[model samples]
Target: MIKKFLVFSALLCSAVFCNAQNAQLEAAVGKLTRLMVTPDSLGLDSILLDNLSYGHSNGGLQSKPQFMRSLLTGASDFVEIDLTDKQVVIQNKIALVRHTLSAKTNDKNIPGKVKLYILLVWSNEKTGWKLLARQAVKVPEK
Candidate 1:
């Protein structure tokens, strides 16, 4: 009976811990999105990993420095970003997040709206959760 009780207690604690971690990760993702739209270099630098791989719907990829430069220089300007249907799965120190992104973008001085299916990979590092990789595919209009 004691063994069973201990096992159950451990499981409960683990579940609670996972829930808390999930909440923290979700908040971090939201903050990163806001920083991306507003182009906060400091926040971006903090939230992104040094070897970030950011992939766009057009099959373009950018390294951490390139991504930051694009956003800072208005090469890929986001006027608004809305995320929906977000799902996060955590395993050990890695998290896989999937979401639908709807945004108004002003890229190269041209304004347009975009809907994309996005996948983001986050790693729980010593500092906190940092975005390690991301890929987005454009959603077709029906």
Candidate 2:
């Protein structure tokens, strides 16, 4: 009976540990999506590194300061953003997140609805998964 109780307790601990990791991932993704899709940029510093590399589907690149400034100024506006088909792979202190992003936005130089495959490399900092690099590829239509 003692052995059985120990086994059950171990299993419960394992389940809890796994669930906590999953929850962390979900929260990280949620924060990132909110930052990307909204005009407010207050919470972005917590989720992204100071030196973030943002690669766009249109073959453009933006640094962290540049991106934040663009969003702050009225240079970019998001109409809709849908993040789907997320796959997160965690290894040690790093994680790779791949997802399908469908978004409608109007920026100062660009305006349109776009669908893309986005891959973001995240590092498990002391806080959580902080985005370090991102690449967006245009989704090919069938």
Q: Whose lDDT is greatest here?
A: 1
Error of 2 at 37 (Å): 2.0
True-structure lDDT of candidate 2: 0.84
Model 2 poorest ten-residue lDDT run? 36-45
| lDDT by residue for model 2 (4-79), tens | 9999999999889767877897788888887777756668777888889999888889998887777777586676
Question: What lDDT tens digits, residue by residue, belong to model 1 across residues 1-142?
Answer: 9999999999999999998899889888988899879987899999999999999999999999999999999999999999999988999999999999999999999999999999999999988899999999989889
CA lDDT of every candidate: 0.94, 0.84
Candidate number with greatest TM-score: 1
Q: Candidate 1 — which pairs collide?
A: none
lDDT of 1 at 11: 100
Model 1 has how many clashing residue pairs? 0
Candidate 1, residue 41: how far the Cα is off, in Å = 1.2
Model 1 misplaced stretches (Cα beyond 4 Å) = none
Measured by TM-score, how close is model 1 to the native structure? 0.94
